[model samples]
Target: MAAQVLALLRALSGPEAPLEELRALHSALQAVPLGELRERADDLRLGPLFALLGPGSRREQTTLCVSILERLLQAVEPVDVARNFRVDLQKGLAHPSDSVKTLTLSQVGRIVESSDAVTEILNNAELLKQIVYCIGGENLSVAKAAIKSLSRVSLTQTGLEALFESDLLDDLKNVMKTNDIVRYRVYELIVEISSTSPESLNYCTTSGLITELLRELTGEDVLVRATCIEMVTSLAQSHHGRQYLAQEGVIDQISNIIVGAESDPFSSFYLPGFVKFFGNLAVMDSPQQICERYPVFVEKVFEMTESQDPTMVGVAVDTIGILGSTVEGKQVLHKAGTHFEHLLMKVGYQVKNASTELKIRCLDAISSLLYLSPEQETDDLLRMTESWFSSLSRDSLELLRGISNQPFPELRCAALKVFTAMANQPWAQKLMFNSPGFVEYVMDRSVERDKTSKDAKYELVKALANSKTIAEIFGNPNYLRLRAYLSEGPYYVKPVSVTAVEGAE
Candidate 1:
């Protein structure tokens, strides 16, 4: 049915062709399920319709052509769309008809948005030059369409790399220098890049994009500001972006948003992105930079950990890990007693159902806190928690053990590294041997047999093997055997029952 209808439509291309047949074919094409059209698209017949989108085509032919391309782009491989219509699509964008230009640009954006594979074609330097040229075209609708296409193209890796590689940003800056209306389209491109591509995000930070984004952040649009915050979060993904953000007083700007969140609920809504932005900034760059730049950031992050809102809590947990992962950050966390208290508070917070990102954050925060904690607090935490071998209450020891058993190797290793660091400390070693099945949890990492487990178990056993740490539990033969199994060598000792101890006494 499609082939027959398409055939009639193609036959109507002549000047003498019937208008009735043109209307019928246009309606027929729209009525066909996109899937059916895709499955039955005869290139031999449809190719000419695609060609009709170029200059000199009649208005009815061009509109129908755009409609067909729209459907095909949705259902077919975007790479195929680029291949079949690349020449015509480019021509349509350059056509005398603004409608043709607009429709072609919209469809091109659709292709770029949907197919990760078609970026290579869209990235063609010459093709991109044409698209960029159209971005400043006199027709307002045409230029907006070009901007929308550029935004979509900026969403993927190849398209983004091309945009970053090309002179597009320079051109965009020049265009926006005098053109206020075009700047909104530029804002769309920036926000789209900030939201979607980390590579693009990093590039935007240095290529005058951070300056533009910061400038536009003064605008009244909530989305632009929200997306600007989002761009900061993306900048957090790379070292360059973070340093640029910090050096340029973006933190001060961000704090204004965070501080302003107190009054405006709508403004407050964007706090998660701010949370992530600050969190990422905390880790990749200097701790001194984060601390010196944002003096109250640690306290802000701590308050968030205890929030009733789970998203705030999750981002806060991640922020804490990054903030405390460094020596300076850890020292800052340790000096402020409440930071560790709040961090330990999250240990048992929905441990079983937490997302992997949250779980990793939990492991990291606990590990860093353990590393920075004073000897007395560390011992108290271990002893009191070890005393709860049979209790329902949450404590740091159980948190460590639970994190060790989690499915993520990175989480397990992070937990174990802290334990290994503390194994030489009496407090940590005592809990390892006496906290009920803790030794087995350390050695029997058959739960996950990956290389990290083997390596972690080796380091842990070597730490626990110290005779000084094992002496207290040697009176229990079960402890002796478990220690022997883990520690190896002359440390191998047999179990003695209670009766034997009684006999000795």
Candidate 2:
């Protein structure tokens, strides 16, 4: 391939612009060793093709010259060649024929892919302005190709930094502002630039690109909104990013769209991304604020958790977990008839079969309930917790046991915490101490040498011992033998085996 580019560069460099008109250059270019020209990139020069690109050049001549130029872009080896081509490509981008402009921008897009070439592209200030302006060109082909080029350039660190340095972000913001069709592509471009490195992402953040993305989130285009959500998720990955979005009213924006999702054509399609953003925002921002801002937020998320799409279910669960973490969020969950129960049922079902991350997230959501401050644990929250305990199904018990026995210390602790928390209530105390295999499950982990696991187990056992139903294990003849096993102390341990589920935490 490199040899081919080198050969093409050689053949194209002859006595005259050998081919009289640009069209001839096209045919001759067909067999040009593009691969070899790229190999000898250091020797490449655009001087020979300047006549065709100059004023008074025929359209066909310019078109063919642009084609060859596009080919020259392939190697990206010679930094100087890329630098020199930019001026000509910028000029050709204004050609009357859309095809010529399209080819020129496409080649420029390809050229900026190289790290070294990206710096060269950014070095010339005027060249940067021209490329950005082309994004909104009258020719649709030209605008789309320009956007494609911008996005491609953003793929590397050098190019992304160039984007920031060259003020291309302002150009993108202008395109998005004018209601231009290319705005969607610009959305995609920002997502690309921010996706690569922290520096690029921070550049987007500080530059107010996130605000543009949030506005795009409510747009009528499903794809545009979805892509914007993707960017929001990226922002939500870091603490400052999430907080920034929340303060920027991004959470409010998402909630509004979701509320109308059922009635709106595009909003429903935006649900998955909306759910994802909700979960992320709730991580640091107040889920209470989300519910307060959008009264229907909880209902929307509850409905989504039951959707056939597993992704919807996962994000719904995530948001619900965050909601349940706060008092206000729990109240919303508690008031939603059967939704809270449905969550427990759905989560219990998924606990055994779901990926480890899902399992842990579900567990964290449920566990958060147990540790709430006393004031937050209202009567409704307590009753809901107790009710969840009273009606534990066979699958639920199996799920609990499965979690209790997990090799991952965090998961085991999360599972046991639920049981320990339930045992605190006198009414639910009997159920906790007497639940089949519950105590032994605790012992299995409690007896382990790992201090965290052992400590969690002792906590579970202590809760059981505090229950009035301690008599059930200590006094009842039925539990007499089981009690003797327990009295044998921590050293009298039972061996347990773990089956690893892929992608579990």
Candidate 3:
């Protein structure tokens, strides 16, 4: 039965093969019992079944072959099949027929997924070259399948190194430069390949692919730009790629994308990705160079805090936060104190009007910036927070209160963190501590809702720890009752109790 199926597939693969003949072949293969087909899947002649998938040829026969291969792959042990016909299968990857190449590559990926030995067979340098060659082939499906197979086979550092040593990187660059549709497909392959072996950075840089891709950042097509962003992101995963980006001045191009407006409908959708790319680049490049080369870029980002689009505003805030946390970034913000104040005012307003996530991001960025700013900037920071706190609406206050109760430790940490910074100041601390027993009020709330107020209680404890006057006030006999209740609070509360007891003694 397997012999008959193979002969029929061969006959149907020919140009002279009639439609009726192909139909007959399909029926015959489909009629083969599952057990027999599974047995034949283990045979070497299974390699020829791939040739039947011609573009204009027997659709019915092709579908049946696909179904049979899917079954056979599931049922047969790939190691047995790989050992029996590994060379024939590798040759099928480069067959003149697109159908053959596609099916062969798909089966290869499946075989590799099923058994590590199959990958060992495909990992041969010569065989790997054939697979990489198919990536530049005219057949889209075949090229894509080849890429998928390469991703699986190149799991090892040695395999990945061999792939980069091959002409695969050059082939991918050619496809990306020449064909728009294929460009998208192949760029993903490039990302996959580069991600697995960052040592491939040498190949990318030597082949000048990095410069080509950097130019794509400003392409008119959003998808092209998006794919470029993904590739660059993956490439930037390595020290070499990061150093190349800095040496090549790629950040300037990325900054242009961020500051420049697009008239296309989908351009706005890509803006967030652009912003994220810049954020990653900021992390990768030296902060001193970023501040020196892109001073205007920094200013524009500060201005983008006012963007009505929440995504744009959120990304901008994140970028600013990243910058502000860096040393040179701190220097930039410190030098531009007036500009920083204006940006903070806009961010505070956005925190009031933005969505909960956006507001949280805005608050985090502002808090991070203030946390990193110098002591001389403390007065300026406090003045801004005071003005914003005074004007906060009921809705804004409710958001802050809800944020104070967030489940994620980090969000609550950020919220209380800003409050700590604000409350440590002379005027702000006096205002908050003297707000008709505000410290007592917070302590009472912390005790009553100990479960939800871990962060709040923690912050209150630290606030007291840092202030002698606050500690003395809490030590008074009237407040001692509240302090005793806090002693019996949650585990996080006990440490503070121990501290207070130590101080009192």
Between prediction 1 and prediction 2, the one with superior lDDT is 2
Model 1: what TM-score?
0.50
Question: Residue 455, candidate 3: how far off, in angstroms?
Answer: 5.3
The residue-by-residue lDDT of candidate 2 on 376-482, one tens digit each, is 45676777776664333454546677677768887887787776666555445455456776555554544456777666766666655544556654356534543
Which of the numbered candidates is closest to the native, going by highest TM-score? 3
Candidate 3 ranges with C-alpha deviation above 4 Å: 1-157, 165-199, 206-212, 255-275, 372-414, 420-431, 444-505
lDDT by residue (410-475, candidate 1, tens digit) is 877876776765665565576666788876675463555677766776676666665464557534
**RMSD vs true structure, all candidates:** 12.8, 13.5, 11.5
lDDT of each: 0.63, 0.64, 0.61
**What's the best-to-worst order under TM-score?**
3, 1, 2
TM match of model 2 to true structure: 0.47
lDDT of 2: 0.64
- The best candidate by lDDT is 2
